[model samples]
Target chain A: MESVLDIKQLTMDFGGLRALDHIDLDVKAGEIAALIGPNGAGKTTFFNCVTGIYKPTEGDMFICPPGKKRERINGLKPNQVTEKGMARTFQNIRLFQNMTVLENVMMGRHCRMRAGIPGAILRNRATREEEQRVVEESYAILKKIGLAEFVNEFAKNLPYGAQRRLEIARAMATEPFLLLLDEPAAGMNNQETKELDELILRIRSEEKISILLIEHDMKLVMSLSDRIFVMDYGRKIAQGTPEEIKNNPAVIKAYLGEDIDA
Target chain B: MNTIKELKKSFLIALWFMFLTFPIMVIKVNTVEQTIDWRWNRLAMVGIFSFFASWIWRYLLQRKEMGQKRAEESETPTLTFQQRVLQNPKFTRPALVVICIFAAIFPFYFSMYQVNIMTTALIYVILGLGLNIVVGLAGLLDLGYVAFYAVGAYSYALLNVHFGMGFWACLPIGAGLAMLFGIVLGFPVLRLRGDYLAIVTLGFGEIIRLILENWNEFSFGPSGIANIPRPGFFGIKMSIHQSLIYIYFIMVAMVIFTIFVVRRLQDSRIGRAWIALREDEVACQATGIDKTKTKLSAFALGATWAGMGGVVFAAKTTFINPASFTIWESIMILCIVVLGGMGSIVGVIFGAGILILLPEYLRAFSEYRMLMFAAALVLMMVFRPHGIISAVRRTYQFEGSPEKKASS
Candidate 1:
C-alpha cells in the first residue's frame, strides 16, 4: 500500500522541552491509523507539527496523494499545508462560533474556490454558479454528517457531539487526501464514540481518505485503526497492529506501569 | 415586595447620581461676574431624571436577562422587529419605495441648511459603511481609518490644484491612493491583533494628521488648500442651491452603490473568509484562508470607501484641511459603525444619521450636546453591545436533496 503521509525522524523542540522527539510515522493510503499515548505525550504537538502550526526542528515530512507524486511539505504555512491536501481538527473544537454550520462548512471550500473581489461584487454568472455549487456541496457534506437539521444554526448553538462531528465534516470539506483528527472522541459519550467509530470507518472506505487520529478512547481506536503507533515522553515507543499494541510490553509499561517481573 | 425593592434600589441610585453631579449640575460659576449661583431647581431636576432613568435601566436589564434565557430555551430564537422588517418583502418593498421617494424630494422640501446637514449625515453613512468592512465584518479595530479619509481628500485637493483634475477623475484616484495607504499600513501591523492593533492604528492616524499639519511644502501646512472645484455637471454651470442638490443626489447615488457592493461582498466567499478570520485566526488559516490576503484585502477595501467619502466631503465643503481629519473624526466614524450595528448596512445608516444629525439638531442645547452623545453611547453599550442591528448571517436555503432527485 502507498503511504499517504510519511514522516521520517520528526523532532520538535520548545526551548529545552522536547515536545516531539524523532518520531517516525506514516499513514498508508485509505488506512485509518491511530496515534495513542497518555496525557501530555505530545500527540497534539505531533498533529500541530504535521499540520504546519508548528515547524518541526528536524525531519522530512512528505505527502503523496493517491496516484500522485510525493511532495515534500516541510516549513509550509498552515493554509499552505491545507492547500496541499492535508486537513486537521483541533482537540478543542474551533468552529467559527458566530457563523452558521453551513457557513462553517462553506469556509472549508475557500481554498478550492476561485472567486475574488470583482467576482464577489459583480456576482457574474460563473461566480453565482460557483457559489451555488459550493452551497450544495457543503449541504451535501452536512447531510452526510447528519448535521443537516442544524445547517442554518450557529456553530456554537449546536450540541457538543454535533460540534465534534461538524469539525470532521469541516475537515472533509477541505477535500484532503490525509485527514488528521486530534481527540475527536473527547468529551463524547459512548453513543457518540460509537458513531464516531462508524464515521471514521465510513470516511476511510467511502471517501478513500487516509485518517490519522489521536484518540484516548482505546476501544474505538483499537477497533477502528488498522495500525497503531504508541508515544511516551516525546518518543515513539511502539508501532504495530491493534492486537500487537494491546499486548506490547513497552506500550503497556508506558500506559499502565512497568512489569514487576522485569 | 419585588417592586418595592426595585424602587428602593432606584432611589439609592438616584441619590448617588445627584451627589456625583452636585458641583457640575447644581452649582454654576459666574466667572465673568465672579459670583457663585446655587441652582436648587437644577438639583431637583437631576434627582427626578436620575430616579426614572435608574428604574428604566434596571427594567431593561431584567428584560435582557429574560430574553437571553428564553433564547436558550427555544430552538429558533424569535426574530427582532428590525429583522422582521428587513426579512419580510411585505414590509421591505413598500418601505424601500417610501424611503427612495423621501430621499429624492428631501432637498426641495427642506431648507438648504437642512439639506446640508443631511448631506453631512450621508457622508458619515458612507464612512461608517466603509469602516464597517474592516472593523465590523473583518473584526479589525482600525483607529486610523480617517487617515484614509484624509488621503482621499488631499489626493483630490492636491491633484486639482496642481493639475486641474476633475472630481469624477479624482474619485477613483483618491480611493486607489487610500487603498495603497491601507496596504502600506497593513503590512507592518499585520502581526498585531486587538488592543495592540488599535494602538498602532491610533498612532498611524495621528501620524497622518501631523504629517499634513507640518508638511508646509506639500499640503500648504495647517492653513490648508482652498477653492477645490466641486463635481461638474457636463460643463454646465448652476446656482449654489442647484449645485447643493446635485451634490446631495450624487451622495445618494454613491450611498446606493456602496450598499449594493457591501451587501454583495458580505455574502461572498471572501466575506466569509473575513468573518471566519475574525472568529478564529488559527482555524481560519487551517481551513485554508490566506490570513495575509484576507487582512490586507479588508484594509484595502475598507480604505477604498473612506477615500471616496473624503473626496465627496472636500467637494461638499469646498475645503480641505488637516483639522478635518483628526483622531476625533476617526473616533466619530468608529462610533457610527459601532452605534449602528457593526456589520448591518441599515444599522450603519441609522447610526450615522443619529450620531451626525443629532448633535447638529441639538445645537439649541449645544451645552449638553456632548453630554447627551456620551450618555447615549453608554446606554447603547449597556443595552446593545452588538449595536442597533447585529449582523445577521446569510442563510442559504437548502433545496430538495440529491437523493430525492434520483427517486423522482
Candidate 2:
C-alpha cells in the first residue's frame, strides 16, 4: 500500500527542552497505525505536528494521501489540515461546551459551508433544505456514534465516555480521510474500551479512513492497530506488526522505563 | 396538496406578494396628497395582510413534512436574521429581498421626522454591525466601543475646525484614529476575558469621556465645537437643501450598504475564523488562527465602522460634544447589539430602531418608555437569549458539507 503520511526527521523544541526529536514514521492508505508511548514520550506532539498544530522545528514530512493526493501538511493551519482531509481529537476534550450538541457538530462543518450570509440570515429555500439535510446527516452520524439522544444537550452535560466519544464525533464531522485519536479509550471502563475498540475499527474500515492513534492501553494498541510504532523521547524506536511489537525488546524497555524482568 | 391547504397557501402567497410589493407602489410620488394616501394604504394593507398571512402560514406550516416549521411555531425561532439565514436558505433570500426593498425605500415613504429618526437608527445600525463583528462574530465583549466613536468624531471635529478641512477628507482620518484606539485598547484588554474585558472597556469609555470633558486644549472642553459641518452629498446639506426625506434614503442606503458588507464578511473565511474563535479560543489557536490578528481585526473592523459613523453623525447634526459620546451611549449601543441579537445585522437595526426612535415616538410615555423598553428587553433576553435574531446557519444542498455535529 502507498504511504498516506511520511515524516522524516521531525523535531520540536520548547526553549531548551526537546518535545519531539528526529522522529520518522509512515502511515499507509487506510492503515490503523498506533503510537504507543509513556506519558511524556511526545505522542501528543507527534499528533500536533501531523495536524499542523505545532510547526516542527526541523522536519520534512510528506503525506501522500490515498487516491493520488499528496502534500506536506506539517506547517498548515488546523483548519487547513482539516480541509486537506485530516482531523484530530484533542488529548483533553475541546468541545464547544456551551453550544448544543447539534450546534457543535455544525461548527465542525464550518469550513465546508459555502452558503453566503444573506442565504444564512434569511434561511432561503436552498439553505433551509441544506440545513435539514445536514441535520439529518448529523443525526445519522450521532446514531452511529450512539450520541443521537444527546443531540440537543449541551456538550458540557455529557458523561465522560460520551464526552470523549463526542470529541471523536466532532472530529469525524469534518469528514476526514485521516483521523488522529488521542487516548480514545482513556478513562473508560473495560466494557467501554471494548466498545471503543470496535468503534476504532469501524472508523478505519467502514469510513474508509486511516487512523494514527495515541493510546496508553496496551490491549487496544495490540488488538486494534494493524501496525504499531513505539516512541521513546519523541523518536520512533521500534516499528512492526502488533505481535512483533509485543516481542520487541526495545519497545518493552521503553514502556517499562528500565530493563524488564526477564 | 390538500384542498384547504392549497386554497390557504395561495391566499397567503397572494397576500405575501402584495405586502412584498406594497412599499414600491406607495412611496416617492413627490406630491403631498399622494404620499399621505399611499402611506395610509400601505399601513392598512400591512396590518390586514399580515394578520391573514400569519393565519394562513400557520395553517400551511402545520403539515407533517415541515417539522422544523412546526418547531419554529411552537417556540418562535427568534432567529436573529443571521440564524434564520443559516438554518434555512429558503426563508432567507426572498425575505431578504423584501427587507432590502423596504430598507431601501423606507425613508422615501415615511415622514421627515420619521426619516430623521431612521437616520439616527442607521447610525446605530452601522455601530451595531461594527460591534457585532467584535462582540458577536469574534466573541469579544467591547464595552467602550463608543470611545472609538468619540475618537472618530473628535478627530474629524478638531481636524476640520482647526484646519478648515472638509467632512469628506476627515472620514478616513477619523477611521484611522478610531482603528488606532481600537488596537491600543485591544493590546492591553485582550489579556482579559469575558467580564474583565467588559469592565476594562467600560473604564476605557469613561476614561476617554473624561479626557474629552477636561481637555481644554484640543477638544474645546465642555462647550463643544458647533457649525461642525453637516455631511453633504453633491454639495447639498441634508437638513435644508437636500430635505431630510432624501437624507432618509441616504441613511437607508448607508444601512443597506453596511448590512451588505457585514453579511459578506459573515460568509467569508475570515468570518468563520471569528466564529471559530468565538466558539472556542483554544481550538482557534490550535487551528493556527493567529489570535493577535483575529482580535485586532475585530477591533479595527468594528472601530472602522463606528468611526465612519461618527463622521456621518457629525455631518448629520453638524455639531457634537463629549456628552454625545457618554457612557450611556456606549451602553445603549451595547443594548442594541445584545437586544438585536449580537452578530445579526437586521436584528441590530431593529434594536437600534426600537431603542432610539420608538421612545421618541412615544412622547406620552416618555418617562416610562425606557422602562417599557427595558422590560421588553429583559423579557426578550430571558425568553430569547439568542437575541431577536441568531447567527443563521445556511444549509447547503451539497452532501460534502459536514453535518452540524451536535456538541457532546
Candidate 3:
C-alpha cells in the first residue's frame, strides 16, 4: 500500500526542550496508524506538526490523497493543511461548544464551500443550493456517527462519548484523505471505547480514509491499529505490526519497567 | 429563625448603604449662608427604601440560583419564558406584525419631536445590529467601533463639502470607506485577542477622533461642519416638520433593509464560520476556516454598517463634529449590543429603543438620567448577565431530517 502521509526527520523545539526530535511517521492509505507514548512523549507534538499548527524546527512532510499527486506541505497554515485533504481533532475534544451538532459538522465543510459575503447577504440560488447540500451532507455524517438524534442539540450539551464521535464526524465533513485524531478515546467508558473501535474500522473500510491517532488506551490501540509506532521521549523507539510491538523489548521497557532479574 | 436571619442581613445592608450615602443624603451645607443643614428626613427615607430593596434583591438572587440549579439538574432543560415566547411562531409572528404596524403609523400619530426621537432610536437599532456582527457573533471586543462611525460620518461630510455629493450618494461611499478602515484596523490587530484587541480598537477610535479634532484645516477643527443638507426628496421643497418625518421614514426603510440583510447573513456559512471562530480559534482553523480572513471580514463587514449609520446620522443631524464621535458613542453602541443580548436581533432592537428612547422621554428627570441608566445596567448585569434576551443558535431544518426539527 502506498503511504498517504510521509514525515521525514520531524523536529520540534520549545525553548530549551526538544519536544519532537528526529521523528519519522508514515500512514498508509486506508490503514489505521497509532502513535502511542508515555505521558510527555511528544505524540501530540507530532500530530501538530503534521497538521501545521506548529512549524517544525526542521522537517519535510508530504501527503498523497487517494488518486492525487503527493505534495510537500511545509509552512502551510493549519487551515491550509486541512484544505489540502488533512483534517485533525484536538486532544481535549474542542467542539464549538455553542454551535449545534449539525452546525458544528457544517463548519467542517467551510473550506470546501465557496459562499462569500455577497453571496451570503444576497442568498443567490447557488448559495442556497450549496447551503442545502451542506446541511444534508453534515446530517449524513452525524447519522453515521450515531449523533443524528442530537443533531440540533448544542455540541456542549451532548454526553462525553457523543462529543468525541461528533468531533470525528466534524473532521470527516472536511472530506480529508487523512484524519488525525488526538486521543479520541481518552475519556470514554469501555462500552464507548468498543463502539469507537468499531467506528474507526468502519471509517477506514467504508470511507477509504486513513487515520493517525494518539491514544493512551492500550487495548484499543493494540486492537485497532494496522501498524503501531511507539515513541519514548521524542524518538520513534519502535514501529512494526501489533504482534511485533507487543513482544518488542524496547516497547515493553518504554511502556512498563525493565525486569530486575534480567 | 430564618426570617430573623434574613431580616438581620437586610438591616445590615441598609445600614451599610446609609453609611455610604451619609454625606450625599444626610448632610447639606449652604455655601451662600455658610450654614450646615442636616436632613434627617432624607436619611430616614433612604434607610427605609434600602431596607426593603435589599429584601427583594436577596429574594431575586436566591430565585436565580435555584433556577440555575434546576436547569443543570434536569435531563432536558426547560426553556425560559422569553425563549418560549421567541421560539413560538404563533406568538412571534403576530407580535412582529403588530410592531410593524405601530412603527409604520407612529410618526403620523405623534409629534415631529417624538418622530425625531424615534428616528434616533432607529439609528441606534441599526448601529447595535452592526456592532452585533463583531462583538456579538464574531466575539471581537471593539471598544473603538465609533471610529468606524466617525469614518462614515466624515466620509459623507467631507465628500458633501468638497465634491457636493448628496446623502443618497454618500451613503454607500461612507460605508465603503468605513469598510476600508475596518480592514486597515483589522490588519495590525490580527494577532490580538480579548482585552488586547479591545485596547487596540479603542486606540484606533481615539486616533480617528484626535485626527479630526487637531486637523483644523481638514475637518474644520472643533467648531465642526454645520448646515450640511438633509437628504433630498426629488427636488421638492419641504418644511422642517415634513423633512423630519421624511428622515424618520428614510431611517425606517434603512433599518428594515439592514435587518433583512443581517438576518439572512446570520445563518449563512460565513456566519457559521464567525461563530466557530468565536468559540475556539484553534479548532476553527483545524476545521478548515481561515482565521485571518474570517476576522478581517468580520471587522470590515461590521464597519460597513457603522459607516452607513454614520452617513444617515450626518444627513439627519445636518452637522458633524469630532466630539460627537467620541469614545462615549462607541461605548453606548457597545452597551446596546451587550444589554440587548449579543447576536440576537430582537434583543438589540429592544435594547436600542429602551436605551435611546427612555432617555429622550425622561428629559423631565434629566438630572437622574445617567443615574437611572447606570442603575438599570447594574441591575441587568446582576440579574441577567446574558442581556435581556440571550442569543439562540440557529437550527437547520430539512425535509429529510431524521427526527423532529429543533426550533430556536
What TM-score does candidate 2 reach? 0.63
Per-residue alpha-carbon lDDT of candidate 3 for residues B178-272, written as tens digits (9 for 90 to 100): 99999999999999999999999999999999999999999998988998889898888988888888999999898999899888888999999
DockQ-better candidate, 1 vs 2: 1
- Each candidate's lDDT (Cα)? 0.93, 0.77, 0.92
Interface RMSD of each: 3.1, 6.4, 1.8
Model 2 Cα lDDT, one tens digit per residue, A30-121 = 89999988889899988888777778899988877667567777667666777777778888788776565665666566556555445655
Q: Indicate the TM-score of model 1.
A: 0.95
lDDT by residue for model 1 (B49-73), tens: 9999989878999999888888898
Evaluated against the true structure, the overall lDDT of model 2 is: 0.77
TM-score (chain A only) for the predictions, listed in order: 0.98, 0.95, 0.99
Number of the top-ranking candidate, with lDDT as the measure: 1
Give candidate 2 misplaced runs (Cα > 4 Å): A1-87, A95-180, A185-212, A216-218, A226-262, B1-111, B236-243, B399-408
| CA shift of A18, model 1, Å | 1.7
In model 1 chain B, where is the ten-residue run with the lowest total lDDT? Answer: B399-408
lDDT of 1 by residue, A9-34 (tens): 99999999999989999999888999
| DockQ values per model | 0.64, 0.10, 0.71
Mark the 10 consecutive residues where model 3 chain B has the least summed lDDT. B399-408
Could you estimate the TM-score for every candidate? 0.95, 0.63, 0.95
